[model samples]
Target: MGLRGRWYRGGTSKCWLFDSKDVALHAPTREEIPALLSAAFGAADARQLDGVGGGTSTTSKAAVIWATPDADADLDYLFAQVGIGDPTVELGSNCGNCATAIALFAVQTGIVAAEDGMTKVRMRHITSGAVLSGTVPTPGGHIPKSGLARVPGSNAAGVPVNLSFHGPWGQNTGALLPTGNAVDQLQVNGRTLRATMVDAGAPAVLIPAEEAGVDLSSMADNLSGSLPTLIAARASAGLAMGLRNPEDPPQNAVPKVGVVAPAGDYIAADGTTISADSHDVRVRMLSMLAPHPAIGLTSAVAVALAASVQSSVVADAAGQAPLPGTGAPRMLRVGTPAGVIITEIISDEKGMVSEVALHRAARHIATADIDVAQAAELSA
Candidate 1:
């Protein structure tokens, strides 16, 4: 058996996208699906040298897409984080970067017809039940490969995919502040640190870098040596969020850990200089316990939401003023190791977040097939 899928560059991430119908026909069972994906990505290999994986947490992902019959949605999208060293595929959350590419994949694959100018693909995440809309450029019933939109960390210019996350709160843990508090004091490695755990697009644990005893300038250089402490903090915060128990190990993906600080100069992963004045806040996030080369899309959304709340640690670190009581959209420029991700958050009259909008660029890379037998046998 073979599965037909397409490879796409979704913002800074890449994924193999399969139509749900095809998935149902070929790899139907959950256990079999992971085996197939692992085979395609060559999992259990840290480098993923023999597979399509780009050898990083960001690139080791997959998506199952389907056109929804529901009148309210145009398509349904499910994201998977394919583990590299472990034979696991987690479907606990959606990937914002991959969400951008899904709109293009749907239109190009004929699941949704492309309109003349901008095509709006209303997407629903199966895991979180959260809704979002992605606006894609279709000049002539086809997405053009060339555009003026430049996404940081992407080498080529591509069509700008504007994504709006609707009702982004509580997508993971059933509460915006999972612990029912804006901030919690957690004991990590015998030291108590105050942290904010928010569940907007994804559950996240935000802590001030200074409180973590990490200097922003040397944070990257020290990340490897400091991972144990950071992981302990995240694990403790996860307990507070109710994502795990005292005896259960922490969920590696959810409640992402981020060390934040006021805007500061830092060298990006590509060796480019990011001036402190270019952004409002500086953040370094970890996915699966490894430092993310860039901020994850869902994590970025959480950061934006956290910044909108005056009492949240993210707002305090960004030096954001208290949100106005009026209903207005606030903009935040988040500086990451890759570059800057700008997010606009809208709040109701009562200062409750209603929507979040962010822009990213994506490109359709290749359409190909993987032999199920080959993929399944690769590990054996």
Candidate 2:
């Protein structure tokens, strides 16, 4: 029998949940994990109709979890990104939304005390061995089932989630800029382009849409409809970030693309309209696969850092407004399709970034078990 799941979402993302017992994972090596995850998601077509995948990279996710042996951590959380139009499942990255689900899952499962005070959860990301600390709201001695907080893309009101990661810069790669610079000029389409490359929550290439010649300020609806030029821009960005192999465009990976501009009026994905003056910078976060209407946790972190620094895309809009230099905690409010995402970053004067904090203002919907043992049977 198939395991039960909820395609719930937080901060503009969703995932397929499998109870720890329902799924079984046995990979002799890390390289084998992606296929295993794709199978668990039961992806038969590009849409993954046979499984819980929602057909988009944001919704196409799988989480394997179970109680852990550590006292500080309640459960072990593993996340996988099954490609939208492809069979490759990437396990090298961490999903902040999935990470949020893990913390909420713990309280809903009674793995931890859901008191009125903040519920602290320490989770060891199996892929990275990185310990993540998360705090979710508990109301009336229970995990708050709902709240009124709303994000750019989410419709429901529930207990907003707060997730924090220490040393998020270069999370998978090991350097903030990864290429050792805040800004890099790349040649694509026979034109020289400037991009701010940062590896905060994920590898991202930030460009000013206006400077790139995309008049986002005048676009009636966030520039809907994809063009070859846009796709080429994104593809070229991925290669410049060193995430894609020059020899194999067919086997390329997602490096994420975003265009920033001064704030202006626009419609959010949820149909809620916003004025550019409502945000510090008009920001759009692109997933490796497509343009996300909103932003990702790590990308938001990178935007916050870039906004603080001078000469970068974000900096061009916000000026050289100095943030707390190096190790000083600061917040960056990004205007997106969902509304605004405020991310915090801790940095030092040495230009080294250490931690990224994401404050999501969305209510916790609910949590259910997926029977991990059952999900594993679908693994190839």
Candidate 3:
């Protein structure tokens, strides 16, 4: 069978988005969605040579979208992290970068009618229960075929999308600090390390680069060598954050794990010299097992929110002063191997987050019918 879907580049990653109505034609039951997506992406093969999967953690993502009748949201999307060299389709977390793409997809496909200039669409994540608002640019009520705004990790340009999260705290574990503490001392890989486990935007754990035994200066070579250590730290944080039990195996999706460091001079992926004061915080988050080419939008929000918490590992790494108690919004500049990305954070009188906004770019890549003829035949 063929399933119709659209491809898009949102922020730093590429994702394939499909309508539930079209997916249902091929998969009659919800239980079959994972297998269907896995087959279409050639999930079992590491190279994904037989299917549309990009053979990497970032590109091997899909989401089933549909217009919602609910009052709180205009549309809903269930994100899928289709495995590479594995057949699991994880739906445990939300993705902000993909949400950026969906905003444009909605406007282009008429799911949300384009206003004259900026079109706003509110989206709800079915898995993580996060509400996102995306503003799409439409000049003369039309989404241009191309754009000039470039994402931090890529040279390619696309239409800009402004995405904001409303009340993003404690969606999964019922508190911004999942462990009831901003920082925790956990035993990982036979070493006790300090970590901050936050549940905002997405569930994530941040560790200092030194305790994680990684050198951010030589990121590429250091990350590949420290994969095993990174995995251990992530698994430990997940259990501490109550994301999983001892019986449950390690999850590659969440809580998103990474090492953080104070701003320092380093070379970016594009061979550009990044100064110490150029950004507020430095992060090297893992997508699956490897270091993500750039930070994921959901994780980026988590980092910013964690940075606001006093004395947290993320907050300590932040080179800037404490966020004001109740005043003007602040931009938290994050330094990644790709480049610098900015997230605007607004705090209320109680020092709690009022809202967090991330600016990203998205554009339509391609649309076609994906061949998943054997999807349903596989046993669920």
Stretches of model 2 off by over 4 angstroms after superposition? 1-7, 19-21, 25-33, 40-44, 71-76, 128-131, 218-239, 248-253, 267-273, 326-329, 346-354, 361-380
TM-score of each model, in listed order:
0.94, 0.82, 0.96
Clash counts for all predictions? 0, 32, 1
Worst 10 residues of 1 by lDDT: 213-222
lDDT by residue (tens digit), candidate 3, 1-380? 78899999998888999999998887777788898899999898799877789998889999999898566788999999999999888989888889999988888888888889888999999887889999988878886567888878988899889999988899999999988997999897788989999998899989999888888774445377678887888899889989999999999989999999999987887678888888988899999888898899999999999988989998899955567878578999999988888999988887778789998889899999877747444333
Candidate 1, residues 142-207: lDDT per residue as tens digits?
Answer: 756656787876777767889889999997787888888878898999988888889998888888
lDDT of 2 by residue, 86-121 (tens): 667766567777777667766766767787778877
Measured by TM-score, how close is model 3 to the native structure? Answer: 0.96
Ten residues in sequence with the least summed lDDT for candidate 3: 371-380
Quality of model 1 by C-alpha lDDT: 0.82
Sort by TM-score, top down from the best = 3, 1, 2
Q: Which prediction has the highest lDDT against the true structure?
A: 3
**Residue-level error in angstroms, candidate 1, position 101:** 0.6
Query: What global local distance difference test value does model 3 have?
Result: 0.87
Error of 2 at 16 (Å): 1.7
List the candidate numbers ranked by lDDT, top first. Answer: 3, 1, 2
RMSD in Å for candidate 3, one decimal?
1.9
